[model samples]
Target: MTIKRVGILGAGKVGIVLAGLALKAGYEVRISGSGSVDKIDLTISTLVPGAIASENAEVVANSDIIILAIPLSRYKNIDPTLLKGKLVIDAMNYWWETDGIREEVLDPTLTSSEQVQNYFKDSTIVKTFNHMGYHNLQEEALPKGDPKRKALFVTGDNHAAVDEVTKFVDSMGFDQVVHYKLTDGIMTEPGSPLFGASLKYQELKQIIDNFDHTDFGRKISSTLN
Candidate 1:
């Protein structure tokens, strides 16, 4: 499916950067903060030129793809009915200091994205845009043919949704690496070796290939869990 409009649900660091990139790529973007539109209007216009500052519902209703950049704890605040049949990108990370400790993510039975999928069952959920730090996002996005282009990993249960998000990622100037399933995405979440790392395609692939055999992956897994 073609994605011309993007709706970002949080106007924080992640949301701001994503909106700016999308707008720069010529996609119509609307970003909403938890507060009223008036509160976010100036910030959206100033930070993300050509992007509209809207309410959450308006943003959700007007776009082809919706990005969840809000805190994981605020997932329940989103209306599933509004998101039904939409492609939703889960860009949230579980931080114990802020989100508090939760057994759902710690249970080992579900990856963080899986938990998000359960909450937004009607929406097509893809796990991405969470591993890299906001500071690296704009600086690291290189053109398609650039030898130094970095790759972003995308994982989801739906192949179509994953493919769609992958194209979107590439359009914003990063290579897209598609993993087959949501379970495989745990390797890219916070604390993993790839998390917050800014690496080129080959370097990132090396980390992913050695993720299981290396002590680095196991150490990060144990530390986060």
Candidate 2:
């Protein structure tokens, strides 16, 4: 899909930051929190000047790409019917402190993105943005050719869907998109060193290369490899 408009499902730090990036990259953005649109109207106006604050369904309806920035525990609350055939960006991590220790998402055999992909069966799910924190997202963006530009990783099952997200990442100023299979998403979860890494392409590339030898990586090799 040619993503012209981006919709975000959460209005928290990650959602707001993503909205700003999408706006900077010349895409129309609509963001929604769980609460009413009235609650985040001012927040979106002040934080992301061009983005609109809309209800969840409205955001989903008007957007070309839907970003799931909500808490991991609340993902099931989203209605999958609205997302049928849409590209869904799963930028959510199953953080225990925030999600209150859910067992369903703790499965080692499958990545969280796998679970999200399963839930939104009809939507093409790509995992990106979740590995980095909101602060890093705000501070790290650099012009496309700038040598200091940070690296971003993209993981998904569908090649075309992933290609679109890779373009989105580069447009947002992160050059050199590192592509991985959707199953390898487990290597970028919270417990993995890659999760919060804010490095250049080559720097992160080294870590990804040696991932199979790491203690944590070895623990999950049977499934991820």
Candidate 3:
């Protein structure tokens, strides 16, 4: 689907940073929090100047693409029906220190995005915007053609959806790496050398190659087995 408007499902740091990127990229942006507009308006105004503040349902219903920047624990609050057939970006990470570890997150058989995709059912769930810290997002992005431009990876089960998000990422000033499936996205999770490091294309690929021959691959192999 052609994505004209973007809806961000959290009003926190990550949500606002992404909203700023989308706004800078010329997309109609709407951001929501658990509270009413009156509660989130100031945050959005100060952080993501052009973004509109709305309730979760309204943001989800009106946008062409939805971004889930809320904590993974709050996934249930998002109505699957509203996300049906939409391109949804899963920008959440499971932090044991904050979001108590859960069985699903630790399940060897499932990638984090896979679990999130299961919940969103028919939505095209693309895993992205999760690896880096929110503070590093805006300033770290180098223009697309810069030789030392940082690269971001995009992974999802749907090729079309992944391609769409790659375009968005490109517009946001990062080079895009496309993984064949959601499971491959684990390379971008915490602990991997590429997780938050601002590396150019070649350096990022080398790290992935190195990671594969080490203990990281053994753990992943066991999980996928």
Candidate 4:
């Protein structure tokens, strides 16, 4: 399926960069921010040409693919109903210290992406675009036919949705798009090479296979602390 239109929910660096790439990939793009329209317009124009800047509802209503490029902490503030039946891409990270919350305690019950999926139950949530930095996202993009291009790992419960996202990832210059079971996304967490470092498909597979599963919750809790 062609991703003809995309709505980016945030006007920050990550959001604008993704929007620009989506536009380059021939998708009609719109961006929304909590900031004023004038400020958003300037930011969008600087980052992405021929893109529209509008209120959140307008962006949501106009686009087929919706990208949540905000912080993980902001998920609670979003109304999931607004994204029902859309392809929602989660590209957020949990920054405990910057969020002014305790760093050592994670809710052992869920990873950040899983929590985002839970919050947006009606939408098809696909975890992607979180593993790389904004600069790398733009600078490291490879041509579609390149043999050494990077791989993008995506996970979601819905097979059809994952396929759609995989195609989008391919269009964005990744030579390989790896699909994993929803629960397997933890393999791509912060400390993992898949988080920010480039790795071949086989290397990524080894990382996943070698991941320690013992007391996973406690392990995550310790990391948070």
- Using lDDT as the measure, which candidate wins? 1
The lDDT of each candidate is 0.85, 0.83, 0.80, 0.75
TM-score, each model?
Answer: 0.92, 0.92, 0.90, 0.88
lDDT tens per residue, model 3, 1-225: 677899999988889899998898889999998788999999898878889999988898899899999987778777789788889989987666656755644455676778888888988899887877776787777677898687777788898889999888888778876775887677777655566777677776676667656747346535433
The residue-by-residue lDDT of candidate 2 on 29-138, one tens digit each, is 99999899899999899999999999988998999999999999899888878789889988898887788755654455666788788888999999889888889998
**Model 1: per-residue Cα lDDT over 67-184, one tens digit each:** 9999887788887787998999999988777677765434555667777888788998998898999989977887898998888888889999899999999999898777767766
Q: How accurate is candidate 4 locally (lDDT)?
A: 0.75
What are the per-residue Cα lDDT tens digits for candidate 4 across 1-225? 567889999888889888878888888989998776787898788768788998888999999888998766677777889988889988877665545463332355667677677778888888888877788888777877666776767778889988888888777776544555665566566655567867555665555555534534336445654
Off by over 4 Å in 3: 104-108, 210-225
Task: Return the TM-score for candidate 1, rounded to 2 decimals.
Answer: 0.92
Off by over 4 Å in 4: 102-106, 212-222
User: Candidate 3 clashing pairs?
Assistant: none
Task: Report the error of model 2 at residue 15, Å.
Answer: 0.5
Q: At residue 132, what lDDT does model 1 achieve?
A: 94
Model 4, residue 54: C-alpha shift (Å)? 1.6
Clashing pairs in model 1? none
